[model samples]
Target: MTAEDPTHPDLLQRWNATLLAARAGREGPDPAPYGHNLLARWAEPQRAYHTVDHLRAVLDRVDELVDQGGEGGELELVRLAAWFHDAVYRPDRSENEERSAALAEKALTEAGLTGHEVREVARLVRLTVTHDPAPGDLNGETLCDADLAILATDPDTYRGYAEAVRTEYAFVPDEAFREGRAAVLRQLLSLPRLFRTPYGAAAWEERARENLERELRELTGAS
Candidate 1:
């Protein structure tokens, strides 16, 4: 499927509905404003790769995996986690995932989700920071793979994603950003597996390695 247009009213409504359902029985503050706030955050000028479009891509991947009968049937929680995972992103901070997870816990709890469910969602949101899960961690594996799926896209698309990420960190000096980004690429390349899900491993591993290796070479000015 083609990339989704996050600006579309229908797409917004779809996500809004998901939020509302999370609190089906609860009488609370209007969730609409919360949804609006998330949209506004994603639209911030500093955000290039972490925009609503990225969220949509992740949600789409989740749906595709579910259709494919991948493990872990916790679809609702996974979807909710996807929405909140990057809700608090900031280029300068290392605590974005933690903050985002906390925000998810608060919002989801207020939305009437059970305490256990809310915590699970928060945990899933936090998992993005490492994107590493134990071998049997189906939800974690699936969500992590979906989040990084862009890494395995075709070269032109990967280039667009890489450039967008750089734009988000435009405040960093070129040399600093290059070194930092190259370090990140090297770390990812060193992983035994880039994606944990069976489908993700099959579809993304080789391509993701190729992208990271090439990008690392270019960033470090390697021959």
Candidate 2:
């Protein structure tokens, strides 16, 4: 379902609550309006892969890591990052991540988060573009892994995710899209590791590689 469907008021409420909880009792502007504004952005029609469902999935992955003791006590900042990671999504724009990071910084600062915490949130959001973090950057690793969790989903779900991404880029011709998508898959395959965290690597690496290669072959008509 699209973000504008209005069937998930609870998710929107949770988004608002998450933001407020990020800076609990600190003095700042009310974050509910900002939360709703972000929800509207996610609901925009140009998005397919990057939507409210994507955000929820990232948050769920964070919870999964937390359950597995992998989050390293940075859950709050990670949640804020997830909320803003795609807040500025533009299917045709290359600077979406940078803009999203800026948005995170502004919103968090307005919400009374300390400058350090705001920087952390923005850093995590920006890392979504590369999905790479220093070896000891647990918060970055956690957010990046969660953002990419869809790559490891079951086949049918993976196919759906692929289609949604294509839909987001529907303006591109099929030939161009195929070339672009194949390039992306090849880059992903070239990575030393798709997932940075041990938990993510163990849980998703093989499946994500299979999914990526399969899609790459299909896109390039390779055997």
Candidate 3:
């Protein structure tokens, strides 16, 4: 979605609120410009799956996890991390997560967040690289779970997600894409659990595994 999209205003409002709450009455520049910058990044033309819609979905899932008692981390930081998680995405690059984390560190620092706050946000952004938070890392678990919640979507929605991901990597040959995508599905299926948060584990884990396995079968031509 672009700046002219209908949801832009509401997203900006959400960004402002989250940033201010994170600051906790500390002084800083107005949040609107920063929101616009991040929004533009999310709306970049090359993005298919990691667009503004994904940003909103992740943020909403973060709220759901917190409200459902699935997460006990610092909500504001998690929200910020969600915003920055795919901010620097490029389909062909493997270093997008690290670049996104660096962007969070620089932008949040310039926006007047404390050093610790900025670092935590960057760390959360980088955690998307694995989506496997270490034990007891509440904030990491929250962000990673929210980011991967798409895997648990209904079959039709999950198909759309898979298609969008394919669109992002359109340069890849069909066979290569299939092989790579199958490998990713296998890796996820091999994980002991797909969702770390209690609510996610209860509500999303089974469906996510089912979706991954089904996709893997399709990709690999398995019986």
- Indicate which candidate wins on TM-score: 3
Q: Candidate 1 lDDT, tens digit per residue, 1-223? A: 1346445565567667776676666676666766776777767777999987898899889887777768864677788889889999889998999999999888877767888889889999988988887788887888999998999999999999999999989999999999999988887887789898888998889999999999999998898
The per-prediction tally of clashing pairs is 0, 0, 0
Candidate maximizing lDDT: 3
Residue 29 C-alpha lDDT in model 2? 82
What would the TM-score be for candidate 2 when compared with the true structure? Answer: 0.93
Give stretches of model 3 more than 4 Å off: 1-7
Write out the backbone clash pairs for model 3. Answer: none
Error of 3 at 195 (Å): 0.7
Query: TM-scores across all candidates?
Result: 0.90, 0.93, 0.97
lDDT of 3 by residue, 55-160 (tens): 9999999999988986478889999999999999999999999999999999899888999999999999988888889989999989989999999999999999
How do these models rank on lDDT, best leading? 3, 2, 1
The order by descending TM-score is: 3, 2, 1
lDDT of each: 0.84, 0.87, 0.92
